[model samples]
Target: MKKLFIAALLFVGMVSFAQDAAQPVKQQRERLTPEQRNEKHLKKLTTELNLDTNQQAQVAKLLADRSAKAQKHMEMRKARKDSSIKPTAEEKAALKKEIMDEKTATEAQMKSILNAEQYKKWTAMRDENKEKMKDKMKERKNKL
Candidate 1:
């Protein structure tokens, strides 16, 4: 009777091990093309902002351009990492300044494209996301 109970416990342990081993690993999301990304952004904005056809067209164009620029910037950054050349303080500052300029330009374009109410909502959303990102970074830093 003791031998039989020991055998049952061993069998249960093996079954649990097999079940755990069979579970699939979580996969990251597949990368999207710039145009597809822009389209996705447009859809989200349209849903949130209730954009009209003309506004949609303008926003689509702006999003596509923004996405393209962002993709290029990321590729450039990756290339810089591959080259093993570390940026100096001045270079880092310049890059940051350029990013800020681009952001300011984008915000201006958005304001021109959207009505006052829509722009206000969009800014609010942007601010909220920025805060969330800051919190996430702070948490990550604390973890480190």
Candidate 2:
């Protein structure tokens, strides 16, 4: 009887370990090209804003232009990071001003392209996304 009890315990332990070992590992997400990403974003905006064909075309062009500029900016940031160089306070202020100016210009262009109602909705969506990003950053900080 004791020998049978010992045999059953060993069998259960082996089965649990084997099951864990057989579990699949998590896979990394697939990367999309810049154009593909822009297209996807454009489609989402079209659905959300009920954009007309002409509006869609304009939005697509705007998205593509934004993506290109963002790619360039990211490369610049990466290069700065790689060089381990810290910007002076004046440089930081200039960079901030440039970013704010670009943002204002982009908003102006979007307003020109979208109708009043659409522009309102776009701004609301943008604010919501900003809040979501802030929450995510806070969560990451807490984790650290």
Q: How close is candidate 1 to the true structure, as a TM-score?
A: 0.75
Off by over 4 Å in 2: 1-26
Global CA lDDT of candidate 1, please? 0.75
Candidate 1 lDDT by residue in tens digits, 1-144? 112233344455445556675565445356666677678879999999999999999999888777667667767767898998988999999978887887888899999999999999999988897687567556645643
lDDT for residue 53 in candidate 1, whole number 0-100: 98
TM-scores of the candidates in the order shown: 0.75, 0.77
Tens digits of lDDT, candidate 2, 16-104:
55667556544534667889988888988899999999999998988887778777766776789899998889988987787778778
What residue pairs clash in candidate 2, if any at all?
A: none
Model 2 lowest lDDT segment of ten: 1-10
Candidate 2 displacement at residue 119 in angstroms: 0.8
Clashing pairs in 1: none
Question: lDDT of all the models against the reference?
Answer: 0.75, 0.75
Stretches of candidate 1 exceeding 4 Å from the true structure: 1-24, 142-144
